[model samples]
Target: SRSLFVKNLNFRTSDENLKKHFTEKLNEGRVQSAKVKKHLKNGKNVSMGFGFIELDSVETATKVCKDLQGTILDGHALILQHCHAKSDDKVSNRADKDKSSTKLIVRNVAFEATEKDLRQLFSPFGQVKSLRLPMKLGNHRGFAFVEFVTKQEAQNALQQLSSVHLYGRHLVLERAKEGETLEDLRARTAAQFTDEQNGYQNSTKLAKKRKHMDILDKPDVMFEKIAR
Candidate 1:
């Protein structure tokens, strides 16, 4: 069957309706079959407003596509393109290792995993200087880079925890590469503004400091408060 992938259909369009409508437009009995894509949501199959139209020949399919592409129905514009033909054989294949950072790249993390949880996972190896997860403007990419205080500690973590499962997915661990800087990683991944943007020199500067009216905006003013 020569099929055309279609999009932006009216939500209520059905399998028979799809074929019937296109068959009418083509003015021929060339439409062989039709299937509307559906979504399973909350125990119901919802129309996805897209589907496939199979024709008797590729020539007929192309003709219908050119004739009806962008035809509007219920204010939704239609998009039409040829569907990928199935090959006789079905096969599947799937496929990391890294470099000089006091850091390790951890992969296959669940989206819900957090920085604190990751810290606890490697804390026994050594003090983690910092941890960074690669993000696309605040979205988790399901991987992270952790910086131990020393390269030796990072190597240790890599040796021990490589291919281990955390949160039900096996992890791929390795030393981070040169390009993955902690500041840039965290700043880009963070949901809020970075410390530099807030006028602070860096995160370390405000990490911890005892406030004693010395916390006032004027840098030199002070009323030293002692712990009583």
Candidate 2:
């Protein structure tokens, strides 16, 4: 396929921006077309934070995948992979079965890390099917669950990211417990809410002090409220 799946895009990234990043910034090759997927939400078009790019040839797509797999753009790392051909229905069916074991529990995430960051961190191993960074009281709980499109991809991420660091903290990656889903993890974490209340007063004080500090304006704030 001459198409490449581009994931972990910034929400504000546009189709033209995506094309320019590849053609101008990276200088990879001519982009035939670039599109950032968007959907109507609350009567507004919102970026789905992923996109597709069509290059000149399969060779160009392969080169792009190799050279730009983890390139950062607009503060979000890009994940590039060759799009799978949909000609074989049997292969597609087989892929559906592979989803059973694709979930991973990511531990020790920096509470300041956003979904985009986690997606950028994991999408290089494979297409991320979905990701969840559970939040409580307007703050992330310092972990996430990521599901890749295939079990092998999930395993690859687990192995590669186990020793990786984000925001100066080492990451702990493990396969999701047998038959564990994101909802189950959410429930488990929710059960621990009472334990986290001990720090709630401190977090609240810090939040109040920093209320005027715009996280949107200064993206470098490192103080993250630990869930427990």
Top model number, lDDT: 2
Give me the runs in candidate 2 sitting further than 4 Å from their true place.
Answer: 1-98, 189-228
Model 2, global lDDT? 0.74
Q: How many pairs of residues collide in each model?
A: 0, 0
Q: What local lDDT score does residue 194 receive in model 1, on the 0 to 100 scale? A: 45
lDDT of each residue in 88-132, candidate 1, tens digit only: 322111001222356666767777667876876666555688787
185-221: candidate 2 lDDT, tens digit per residue: 6676556555676579779988877875665555555
- Our model 2 lands, by Cα RMSD against the true structure, at 12.9
Model 2: weakest 10-residue lDDT segment is: 219-228
For all candidates in order, the CA lDDT equals 0.65, 0.74
Clashing pairs in 2: none
- Give the C-alpha lDDT of model 1: 0.65
In model 1, the Cα lDDT at residue 77 comes to: 78
* Candidate 1 local lDDT, residue 71: 81
